[model samples]
Target: MSQPPPAAHHAGHVAVIGRPNVGKSTLVNALVGANVSIVSNRPQTTRHRLLGIASVPGGQLVLVDTPGLHREGGRLASSALNRVLNRAARGALEGVDAAALVVEAGRWDEEDALAYDTLRASGLPVVLVVNQVDRVADKASLLPYLQRINEGREFAALHPVSALKRTGLDALVASLLAQLPEQPPLYGEDEITDRSQRFLAGELVREQLMRQLGAELPYATTVEIESFTEEPSPKAGVMYRIGAVIWVEREGQKAIVIGKGGTRLRDIGKRARERMEQLFDAKVFLQTWVRVREGWSDDESALRSLGYGDS
Candidate 1:
């Protein structure tokens, strides 16, 4: 098939959607060439839609990392937070130039089917990205897997990738870029993401908390940046002083985040500060406070106060 006419320039949004643990967040970071979203093996790690802008030769690819689509049940999944997240994920598809539905290379499940159906119904240009191929033992297995995926919908293209390994990413980006029309860049070429430094700072701390606490990380726990101040340094660099609070629904959850002698909280702060420093290209002084905001996840107004992507 002949390629579409080349545009002098291009800029468009591409929404990446998948079920939890399918490596959608990892792919966003890889495509952006920077860490714009938090990633973990845990389900629901990405709780909202995030934008990671990648500058290509011809255009900027605004990649939207949508939250994982899961079966909702009980009070937790039905809570105000969950509803907002799910809506935000689906809402991201609106007005996007194209969409990428990521699935594990050798695995298919009910959630994947639901996500596929949702994307098809949206009537957008869809690309099937079979991610995590590095974990697939048999390379030949992808042929049949790709066939099965194609049977469900008419995709623009199919690409198998290992988002964690940065394999086959160039082709995937090329495929999506082909579908976008020419336009001016939406953001500066040097900008990796549209999110604020404060928002990413809070996410880094939450990532550390999730990694450190593991199973003990409360579903209702959230991190908020109260004050983010920057000042000139002697070395002709800006230094950031940030104050943040970790809000938990209960006192016990607060104890888990703070830990004994505040060791865990300190660790979380340290790691988050290091990441912030690298991202901002400056030194960081981060102060984290653990506070009990009882039932914030369940409380509509409280979730609003916590603030997250598009919510």
Candidate 2:
């Protein structure tokens, strides 16, 4: 196939919007060919807006991955944190060329509708991304589900894909590129994300916390990088020395993260370091500690200080 001329290429920002835990970050990571955004099974695992840049054959996609949109009134929702997350997600929509409304292959709910409505109000071209089709035992049922979601809704394109498996992405990319305006690449092809390595380091530790602790983990718990230093290494090209502090609401939660005899914390640090080595492609020395923050998640000032502000 003949390559499109440089003047014919399309490049623009696209907001990835969805309800909590619908694999928005996973899709972005798959498209970017890197783990620029953190992923976990927990709802609202993504707390900030980050951009993943994917330079494909026909064009470049600057994907804005945002926190899942959820109602703030639930008992499980921290009013302040929920407000911050919702604001961050909504704020990410500004100046984007298009939006991708992600949803699980077989599921749709009020929150899904809310996300779609929010994007519709923005007046951007939306592409329905039916993600996680690999999880569906009955593939035939997906057609009806897709039709149901499409009812009374207008979308620039729709695709069923498995972000984890990286299937059905070529078509998705082509569809999204058709919606974008023809232009040059907005970023260097080598650039994968807008977030710095320091931010990603903290998120890697938090990903461990969410994956390991599961239901035992408190919503108030967050990872903060106290120190991030890079130094020369004899064997490796670069070495990163990182210090992470896990903040919890109370002493009990701190104990849960630290675990008995500090085994849990060690595992978290070890896994996080391995991931960092992979993502940064450099040796990493990571140290972690758990501390009680009383009520940081609820305090708007503290949340901003911890890097949870609207982005």
Candidate 3:
């Protein structure tokens, strides 16, 4: 008789949860080996649940990158941010194999403690991941605290990883793989992420906006892809017609984005166009318009339309 085939491997979901600027997006990008989620120095850069799939020789791991959790006053933007947090808190951990709680090295405080408490309350197998290890000057100083956090708690494992530097990731992946159950893959082996081309394009534009326009401007702005169309060109180039709406709060802010004599808007458009072309691998014609929608973030209907929902 012919030899039987090898047994199939199991796939699992791993939620990367933490407060803002904790390197969660960086970790997801490192694991997926692609820039599926945009990264920046600003806090709360990730506004939604970004699904990145990591496939290995034996199995696959679907990582969910969520927005940071924090307390915000009653406002449409704050409400939307809270919705993203709750979705991951309730959905990602349920029936999942494990969760990696990403924390900043040498920065443990009450907020971090609260996040750890929440993870413990969830009753899922938790792994304490001390991310940004490169930022810490004294690694030995953190060991006592890590030991304290591990004491009396049932953590599947503890890992010190520098997601940005690509340190200790192999061991972390190995630990996650060992914890995963034996079964078939949850997603296609070749699939990397679930985000659409339009969504990724919008996100890339938003990332550029954040990088160019800092501070309150990044938080106040939102990018929405209005139209995307492709046209064949034999001589000039393959043209991709793209339109986006940049939302701001005040008319003055709109003026700033538009710039003096449209210089600023021209720059923004040029940079965004370059990125879109590279992403789609075609020449892109980007058209962007800025609009002032005062208090748009507080509008429930607006929030829902932007893809924030109560779960």
Lowest summed-lDDT stretch of 10 residues in model 3?
72-81
Clashing pairs in 1: none
Q: Rank the models by TM-score, top first.
A: 2, 1, 3
Runs in model 2 with CA error above 4 Å?
1-7
> Which residue runs of candidate 3 sit more than 4 Å off their true CA positions?
1-8, 72-90, 216-218, 233-239
The per-candidate count of clashes, in order, stands at 0, 0, 4
lDDT of 2: 0.93
Candidate 2 per-residue lDDT over residues 25-85, each given as its tens digit: 9999999999899899899899989999999997999999999998768755657888889
Candidate 1 has an lDDT of 0.87
TM-score of each: 0.94, 0.96, 0.88
Residue-wise C-alpha lDDT for candidate 1, range 216-304, written one tens digit per residue? 88888888899999898888388889999889888888888899999988998898888888877898889999988777787778777
In candidate 3, what are the lDDT values of residues 175-216, reduced to their tens digit?
Answer: 777777888889888788988877887888788777777663
**Which portions of model 1 miss their true places by more than 4 Å?**
1-7, 309-311
